[model samples]
Target: MLSAVLLSVLAVAGQEPPRDCARPNGHLETVACYGERREQVEADQRVILSRINARLDQLPAEGGVNPQQAKQSLEQAQSHWAAFVAADCRAGEALFGEGAAFALDSLDCEITHYQARNRQLAAFEARYGGA
Candidate 1:
């Protein structure tokens, strides 16, 4: 049963596959594209995080808010957010059951979380001043 489902997913993904991710063919293809998009978002997040870190490093302890403490807080928030995203994706997979559908659902959740995080970082930069 699993093999049959896998083969079907492969067939759908391969059949007249789109040249770009904008038009994915099936659950498998969409999942692949989502994975690519997630990677790109993560890369962007890294660059943004570095800029934010640099800005944080320049700020002195004003009003009892230490620069090191601020940096640590940001790190802890990001770490916890990542764990939540992973757990959410796992929940999505379980919701969809055992198949390619499950994989696609998980990828969808991941892409959503990555995009949301990137937006959050952008907003943070806007508020705190960063590239």
Candidate 2:
């Protein structure tokens, strides 16, 4: 199944995810995969936010919202989003109790949240990013 695909990936024309990370060696490695995913998503989101923040600094105030106020609002939204992700993931982990799956579930939840947030940020840039 997954093992066969992982083994054959190197022989195929296209590249594939690393065998250990894709299939995972154990629960620990399985959790590590989520960590890697979270890192990638967060890194992407950071770049987007940085660009938006820079734009905010350069642009003139819009409507009643000044650049500084907009940045502060963004900061607050980001902080609230982070808190929600943490609390929700902790709740998910609680459902699984003391087991290897609990940690994996929590990490998976965080990755899902972060990925969704990344998409939202990208869409924001696409809509509002001025040249």
Candidate 3:
């Protein structure tokens, strides 16, 4: 199960997902599909973040507004956000209990958070003059 999820993440990062997960027929497939979608969103977020960071790099340094400091802050925020997502998923798993649906609930939690983060990164990219 863990392997499948990891594969899905790696697959989406390097290439297209093996299948369209928008409509999965069973629990196993749904998990894989959600992993794919989550990773896809994550990949998109990385691109947007990179672009924004680059733009930040080009800004001239001013008193109390250092571009390097801004970049570091973004990096720290993203790392903390990732940790929060993992912990949040664990909380969801606990709420769902140890049942057949436990894994699904956790995956759903991850997917929801991934989508939200992607939206935030995308909006930031747009605000920074779109990329």
TM-score for all predictions?
A: 0.76, 0.78, 0.76
Top model number, lDDT: 1
lDDT of 1: 0.74
lDDT of 3: 0.73
For residues 23-128, could you state the per-residue lDDT of candidate 1 as single tens digits?
8776656766766666687788999889889998888778886878878999999999989987777777667798667765666677788888989988998887
**Prediction 3 TM-score vs. true:** 0.76
Off by over 4 Å in 1: 1-19, 25-27, 62-65
Q: After superposition, how far is residue 46 of candidate 2 from its true place, in Å?
A: 1.1
Residue range 18-118, candidate 3, lDDT tens digits: 66566676765676676666668778787878788888988888767688887898899999998998888888767778675876677677778888887
Runs in model 3 with CA error above 4 Å?
A: 1-22, 128-131
The clash number for model 2 is 0
**Winning model by TM-score:** 2
RMSD of each: 5.6, 8.6, 4.4
